[model samples]
Target chain A: MGHGGGGALSAELVENVFLPAFGGRTLAALGDSAALSLGGARLAFSTDSFVVRPLFFPGGCIGDLAVNGTVNDLAMSGARAAYLSCAFILEEGVETSVVGRIAGALGDAARAAGVEVVTGDTKVVESGRGDGVYVNTAGIGLIPPGVDIRPQRARPGDVVLLSGEIGLHGVAVMSMRQGLEFGVEIESDCAALGGLVDAMLAVTPDLHVLRDPTRGGLAAALNEIAAAAGAGVVVDERAVPVPPQVASACAVLGLDPMYVANEGKLVAFVPREHADGVLAAMRAHPLGAAAAVIGACVPDHPGMVVARTAFGGTRVVDLPLGEQLPRIC
Target chain B: MGHGGGGALSAELVENVFLPAFGGRTLAALGDSAALSLGGARLAFSTDSFVVRPLFFPGGCIGDLAVNGTVNDLAMSGARAAYLSCAFILEEGVETSVVGRIAGALGDAARAAGVEVVTGDTKVVESGRGDGVYVNTAGIGLIPPGVDIRPQRARPGDVVLLSGEIGLHGVAVMSMRQGLEFGVEIESDCAALGGLVDAMLAVTPDLHVLRDPTRGGLAAALNEIAAAAGAGVVVDERAVPVPPQVASACAVLGLDPMYVANEGKLVAFVPREHADGVLAAMRAHPLGAAAAVIGACVPDHPGMVVARTAFGGTRVVDLPLGEQLPRIC
Candidate 1:
């Protein structure tokens, strides 16, 4: 088989990768479409794909990762996440239990996020044609009244805040893939950012930009924002947080903490005047307990991002020059 | 490289499989997303996948496929087709072109869909751990009150119509995989069904169930409708047209004409009184000149479909016992 099989394989992908990530009451309807009530506002729609390897990793798996990834993307834009559609690709011979666990996790996570997995599809390939399972999730959310946020809105004087530590997700997943287990648990930083987003919105309706560092990590995300907003960004390295385990792993792997992915964290840009209020709201959320003002926009570094080192040295953080942890996300 | 890359292999799959079958504007967009308005609706959607052979096949593919496929999927759903988030699995090696093409295709498809490629991710695989590219698409569609239709609405007195000849799409692509050219050329029926869907909706507000028979052919579609609406469908075999080239190819391959897949074609069920009006409307469209009233819904054999044979013998059509064509879609 190539892909798009409506059988066990397809079932596995959905059960494993998607259902766990996005399963909810609306999703329980199992209808071809998810019926939703937006409470009246334009919908902010988004979709995402997850082709992670080892499909199963420490802390969380692809199922929850996929669900939260899309939900967070929608939330970043200040949208109240709603329904989701999933599609899957399975390499033949993948264990049914693995898929089942993934599905269960995805379902749990989605329910937690209050998002529903409405409709989905699956396809399977012969042993040599595909990976174990690859998932794609498309989500829709309604933007509440007075909440406007986008990368372009990061003004010159806006404050850049980070929700938590970085690289835990990439390192946790990598450790599992490499069969390395730490005596102390180090969970992947996989989590849905919707709650944190909501809290931020509760305090600052005019938040400028919100982004989660995934594939290319914080550096990739911030640089993208810099380019999109046409504004320079400056951060104090001393203020950036990284767990000891994550830092150790990155150092040993010769990887940059800033370039490693983080699933549960978010970086936000808000009016300088509202930064403290927004930080307080973010810190109130468990996912954003480590929230801190990390940087601010500057005119001179348009589309450029620089950081003051822990050694008090300034270094320009250019766009990722090479692939980071290959596909640690 | 995993799927979604837009490199040589991806190109080969497109040229050899998808392009010949689904050539059109949707293909032309080739972006991270497609941009289009649903006229009065404030919604966007599309669907697609990149299940090309040689998984890590040409160019920076797999990753890109995941992006483009989802973007296209949303387009088919008849929405503005806003944003996409991508996931990937990478085999060892699978160079930059692999990543670039996938990234590029995502960029291209998004540009074409008139939507932004907002978020994404990447993952690596152990050698022999995963195949190259296997893309899946999950899209959204905005439904306007006046354009209500679904598979379950086929009334007993309604007529059946097809966007184009059946099986050509499946035949074209299969022909490529088998290396059995039609001499006159048989391309894969890989195409985006958005425009034609739009056209169909424009023609009749009375449109009922609209289905794209990617796998299991037109027969599968009809059977599905029969089951969904709890009605019998009887087709005048003669009226259900097939291209000479397609028929000839099927004959040599020993494949049933009704069991093949179709990428670009759609089967529609409409009220009997409106069948002629809809046929005329479809035939006038470039992609639907072969549109016809192949059958009608009836009260007999509830939940079943019967196709009057060319030899005048009636045959029961069921959802192809298992799957007649695997991965055809």
Candidate 2:
């Protein structure tokens, strides 16, 4: 289970097992999506399999997550998703009604995202061999001209901006799984980010890097960008937004908000000169109303991410060795 | 399990559950792959999930099947696969060596087919929640200009061609699973068909329809084409090739050779004028060495397939309700 935790174990699996076996320059980049040129069109291709334990959650279901997850991956590359291919693995004896509900959610989500579910496949396993349903979605999107966003593009002096409050998605799923009630109901931030990405791109196509803080969360995304660009990231912890309910829930659960996943959010590394313009654009978008300038790429301590505490002490924000929460996405 | 059998159940799932939910013309076509235009380029996209038991089979394992399945789907649309995305759902304790082996085979298969695995994802489930491994591969391919092929394009005068012998893949996996002994070992016809598709396209790009006789085998492929084209198909059973060993195994197993799965074979519907040239081209290709003109589309009894038996009687070949051999692919 740790292998899928989207932390050090996941990274190691990709680097040691998959990378060596499937040797290619495009895959070696290890970005949120692979950037490719096919028939004179710049395309971003991405794949993600969703296996969240519960079929339904506080704010959304696995179907929407399956659609939004791949959409967000493409959006991270500054691409507008054009089409998606969905494949479902269902365990025998699973109710057709359950499958119907999921299919409806998936369709609604794709339409909301303005992408088409063009091709798909379905397979069934013996009843005990699968967890009701598992969906894998692979998406194709077209990257606009002059847009080259990747982790490697982050450089010193780049400003890092975060789209919204963290920990809602993680807290929402965890609370439901554990059946823990809070004073306020927490909802998963599951959403498609294509429109928000387009708005950001409109400000300037020169955005350096974009990442959705999924799986391993904001900490992992920041650490990855820093490592890939060989730069240091310095974050002001106070500037990071955390919902009071999520903060209280995390306190009760002994989890760090920085390491919690956010489905509808994105973290961007932009040139300092365009930072204000991009932030303004993000704020104007409904999905990015809570956007904030949280950090900056620094020349010192290359390949590391450090956060300043409220009391002014600095601490390293390390890439998690394994997930604090499993199957949260 | 029947839902994934690629017969009536699978078709119903697509029509009743997926089609209504997805509500798209591209998916409604119900071909082996979906054809679309992106940035002025005609593209084919397809997805398949492989969950065959035992991991290793007589001729090939799940690895090659995962890669070749999606490639064949694209080829059915007269497209040359360019890129693939691979996602693995692994049980918690699956050996890394086992994953390594599968990965290695997948890479080799991709290279052999001249396609690249550009992006991928890995997810892990608890031990009892999953089989040892399940692989999902989604592919994108380029359809050459002036090339138009689809099941609906099969016309009344079109001649149907079978690429080679059937039942090898189904019998091979079944023998391994059931430990049934045959005098001669039956190896699966697991192979990539992109090159063969390219060869046939070379003769003429206007081939009406090309289908891989996998899952529900040649019978299902023929039935689907006939139904989609709203034409009647007449097949001479004796003209269809079946290896002697495969024939004996199916006879002992009480299975119909036409209903058995084939991984490396294709059935093509061609215009009568170009039939000879297309058949010649298929025969010249290594994958289609035993290509045979097994049938013809006729105007009578539309949406049905009838096979001529040795006893000089024509019998309706019904679409199978469910798979005779599950997970054969």
Candidate 3:
């Protein structure tokens, strides 16, 4: 295991190792979720393991993060999540109260997302062999008819819309982990995006691509889509919204907001004609009130993402070599 | 996390913590797998985490065990596994070659089991926080029409049939971990049982209950079924089949074969009228050549399992308070 950071090392691991070992057409697509068909019904399947440190955070904990992470992945495929399987690995001697709180949080999150935890497993390890608790969730969702969303669908003239502010989750987790007091406390933006996704799908089911920028942040997500579609993404740096506190924290910590994780946000690549309607729908949703048109897919500089700065200078926003914040969820 | 054993503590954790936290009719059943209806298709879903020590065992490695474990869980619900999602938490500094071997074995196992690895994830943790590698697999299978199976379906006069020999899997892993020589090398019975289940299902679709004797072994499985169905299981001690080598090793180690884990074996509760037909079908399958009728459901002493001793005495076989062998898959 080279590095857990969702960066070049992670990409290499998947390309060099996992892809060769687990060969199949769906996995080769490398989307946030895999679209599948079972018994004539279209489905989306995805899995994620949460190892976030400092179990409890300002706005959410690992419990809710575990539930939302996989749910958001399924939503990215334009699927409404229906069922999930949860597995927990706990360390010996860990407080049962801590586990109870986590389980309570998980239950609440599942209820809020309107999905059921249909099956689960629990395992315990010796005290020193594991962190307090690690959770893995795998989910299956129903892909509505006439909807197809994937990274490779990003083509020239597609509008790139971001759901809200960036970098709050990474900044929030890091501040709590290091005991740094930013004048204003920043809470993690961890929430289920299924409702927001459904709202956008109502506007149009012909979305080209939808991605939740979690690990490696917006930069990584755009880079992946660019590479997959063999198209360039040109962004208006000034158009991207960053809250005041998160901006100050990232500046003080020398972390770029572009590469910081956001748990409750999504970036969509939509056809230009439907972009206005989709943006309107997203703005109406509570979760996407601050949605903005941050960029657009371009034909120039294929397989790259370029940002036009306020000073009229252009720079490439590349995928980070490693994560700036590890275990941020 | 009192003990990582699938005994009293595990049961309490599920009953007191998980059950209340994740409440739904499907999960309330507490079956080996959850039977669900999605878009007019009946599906079986299950998940398992493999933390067995000594990644490479006598007969199989953690990779194949991960696939087969979840596959077997789904098969217990009489479903043919179609897809799986694998998530790996790797410890830093683990050799890439070792991961390669594990992934290779996983691919081979999935092919052998006739399931596809559709989606997966990988995360690396700092060394010492995790064992070399831990795998979690969640699978979904299509349940055929007219088949209804669950633990609560057992009733009086139902015959209990075991798929094959017991205790080899736990013994094989233990010998490797502690470097113990039992005179004869015992390989783990770690094969997928989907084909064997299919052969059994060919005879009839009205089987009552099916369980894979894994972590807590035959005793635990029987106790669970008896409790669920509010019936007693009466077993003829002489009729339960244990291999001679396994019996010898268990005797030397002061372990009872009755409480030892078996990976590729299953115990089925069949209506007495159909017992002979099902037994013949099981015996005809390669994985169930040693199938035997070890017990029968009875009305006396409900919610317990009793084994008739060779001396014609009956004794209750209580579930162990903790596991005799920890991390035996």
DockQ of each: 0.11, 0.84, 0.72
Candidate 2: the clashing residue pairs are: none
lDDT of 1 by residue, A118-209 (tens): 54555656687666777777777777767767777789999999999988888887777777766666788788888888888888799988
Error of 3 at A144 (Å): 0.3
Kindly state the number of residue pairs that clash in model 1.
Answer: 95
What tens-digit string does per-residue lDDT give for candidate 1 at B42-93?
4444445456543332122333444434543443333324444444445555
Q: Backbone clashes in each candidate structure, one number apiece?
A: 95, 0, 0
Q: Give the number of the best model, judged by lDDT.
A: 2
Candidate 1 error regions (>4 Å) = A1-41, B1-48, B54-132, B189-195
By DockQ: ranked, best first? 2, 3, 1
Candidates, ranked, TM-score = 2, 3, 1
* Model 2 misplacement above 4 A: none
Query: For residues B63-150, could you state the per-residue lDDT of candidate 2 as single tens digits?
Result: 9999999999999998899999999999999999999999999999999999999999999899899999999999999998998899
Better of 1 and 3 by lDDT: 3
Each model's lDDT comes to 0.65, 0.93, 0.92
RMSD of 1: 10.5
Q: How many clashing pairs does model 2 include?
A: 0
